[model samples]
Target: MILEVLQLVPHPDTPAKAVPSVLCSLSWQDAGHWVAGFIVGAPSEALALPTPTRPARTDGLWQRTCFELFLRDPESGAYLEFNFSPSGEWAAYRFDGYRAGMRPLELADPWITSTDRDQFNAGMGAHLAALGLDPASIGTLLSTPMPEIPGAPAAPAQYVLNAHLEDPALGAAKTWQLGISAVIEEADGTKSYWALAHPEGKPDFHADACFALEMAMSR
Candidate 1:
């Protein structure tokens, strides 16, 4: 499993008036599951969060305060986007390249939970397979070999397994550039855009430059 602890910075022109910080954690398990957790460093009453409701796939969650995840294939430039609301609503979209050819990414419902108006969590099942990857191929990729390094000690078996997870020859199923972002709205209606990185000009969560985090996946 690969785990990342990350922080989101507000876009230079759009600063949070009430939210002090946004810290996030992402974990990718070998079983093809993903869990994302976020801590909004402010009282729930201070933000204009969505009303709680039954968990379901919904659109336009980004219009207000919402957490998001972006996964891109570096080689083909294809990507997927997910929006998670504190109210248990969510959305998923796939792009052909960059932000082109968008369509819903169908999958089983993800489990979501929130607490204390400060913490939010979303858990998703085998999304790699849902993204059109063959289950058998993923198992093979996990065992792929790594090239030898001259004058360097041999890597452990597990290290080799992780290193080759990004082999492009195997296709987009194995590697990804990740982006974590959020649209935060204060109770009084002030809004801020937070992301790992932002492009100059406007707050475009779909910007390629914002997908700053990288991941190499195994089985």
Candidate 2:
């Protein structure tokens, strides 16, 4: 699995201090496994990171330096939000549509580890049942071709790397639009929002425009 290195840009209104940049890499593994790595190009002492603690599900992580992932199913408009903190804490939430009907998504806790305050790694696995997806249907969709739209340019066939299609029984093979973002807090309490893409005005990670990375297994 090739990890795609992506550069996250800070919102224009909220410029970063001390933190030079944030690089994120994501790769999918077989059998519902995926890993994300983040490298913060900044002095470890310049950022205000939460103190180390026993890994557990915690709320309000984004208030500090936190890494976030937003996954959306294009067809259904349902999405999952995962938050990983440098302190080995994590949170997961499910939304019905565009932030409606939110609830805690209880699953096996993600394994999060960080190197000082400059680098972090998060790994997790979720079954199709947990995501409310039908494995057989997704398998069929993967085998079928998409209907072309009128006047639209032809699109090349694309699939998520390491989608595990060889074994449809795995049940967690499907397409997803991912939005990666982070909230960086400086030692002096300055906060900046970073993301692959930002909406027009304020730094809104929940906006649809932020979900720009397309990893289609069967779009």
Candidate 3:
């Protein structure tokens, strides 16, 4: 159940005059019965300007920037909030699970690297450690690079994931992964969370299109 970001069409009402320099690419796999997706971006050109301005009130800019994970229940949805630091070298995502009692999942240290499983595991351990999670207890890792989507630019960074987190409470371990992207921003802690939008059409899995749309808004 992997959802890939195949294409991104600008809103018809979007002024043709303002085109974005970057687009998003998304891919995912099934974790248990639920689907999990990773998103990355390909920059058409170097981001020369500051953050783009928010799109028209009609455009669903919020849905694009924020990662929404829909569960079996049609009414249930989990959101991973994204924020770009003021310096623009890092981006952070905070995953708020469906259940209100569950603590939010936060990933702040994001980087690109060769498809090295050991290195990726180490990085994931460090990332979790930063969040006060014990890495030693989280066990049994399997990872792979996301498949390339049609029309997406050559990926500047590769994404890899480690599934099966060991948790005694669930009788079975939970599945999760690490998604990396090209845009780099320093985590300054100023931006709280990315807003969610409900554009006219269905939202795609890719974050790049949403980020690009958000960037365009700043311009």
Candidate 4:
């Protein structure tokens, strides 16, 4: 699923009042894994990023510059939330229902690609070009290699998400609505919310069932 940042709600002090369009894409990996990639077409130039820290689980990563993924369980109505900060800080939270039973969700094999900014692009390019986007975000765990994406760019993308889970009911053959979004914070502390589809009213991502696409597990 590819979500275009249409409603880029920026703060009054936002550096880019009219930030260019941002594209966020998601993929489902073996059995129950997920990979989400985010790229900003507006400004590929380096923005003042938050301080780099060892990749670890930390809360409130979303309050600053971060990328997020939301997954809903059709059977129990439970949901999982993940936060990826450009600084290499990450966090995961699970809820029994909408805004309920909030707790840390242990992530297996979670990794970050933003540690070495210098080689970020080169690494991403090579990773995506060779393996395509399928497992690039997650690493090599695919039982069946993903088919190359036609006409995909040669350069590597900056932000991509990788996650995995195991569920018997919601199998690979069935597709589900995936939510992809980004929270950008400028040097001056201006914040903005971007996504493929934003519902009416405030910038709450939980609403509108923001199911941007019927994404399935495949190439």
Global lDDT of each candidate: 0.71, 0.71, 0.30, 0.56
Ordering by TM-score: 1, 2, 4, 3
The runs of at least 3 residues in candidate 4 whose Cα sits more than 4 Å from the true structure, single-residue gaps closed, are 1-18, 42-46, 115-174
What residue runs in model 3 are displaced by over 4 Å at the alpha carbon?
A: 1-3, 16-23, 29-73, 83-104, 112-219
- Tens digit of per-residue lDDT, candidate 1, span 1-219: 677879999998988887888877777654247778777778777888777666678998899888888888888888888888877677878899867999998655665666522122111113344456554555554445556789998532210000011112222237788899989888999999999999999999989879998888766
Pairs with backbone N, CA or C atoms under 3 Å apart (clashes), candidate 2: none
Give a tens-digit lDDT track for model 3, residues 1-219. 343443334343331222222223333222222222232232313212223222111212232222223211112233333322111122223334332333333332332211234544555565566578886766454344567799988745433222221112211223232222222211221111211222444433233223332110000
lDDT of 2: 0.71
Instruction: Give the worst 10-residue stretch by lDDT in candidate 3.
Output: 210-219
- Tens-place lDDT per residue, model 4, 77-154, is 677777877666677788787788999886552555543453343334434554446535544433234468889865
True lDDT of residue 27, candidate 4? 49
Task: Count residue pairs with overlapping backbones in model 2.
Answer: 0
What does the lDDT come to for candidate 3? 0.30
| C-alpha lDDT (0 to 100) for residue 148 of candidate 4 | 83
lDDT of 4 at 77: 66
Off by over 4 Å in 2: 117-171, 217-219
Per-prediction TM-score to the true structure, in the order listed? 0.74, 0.73, 0.29, 0.64
Looking at model 3, residue 82 earns an lDDT score of: 31
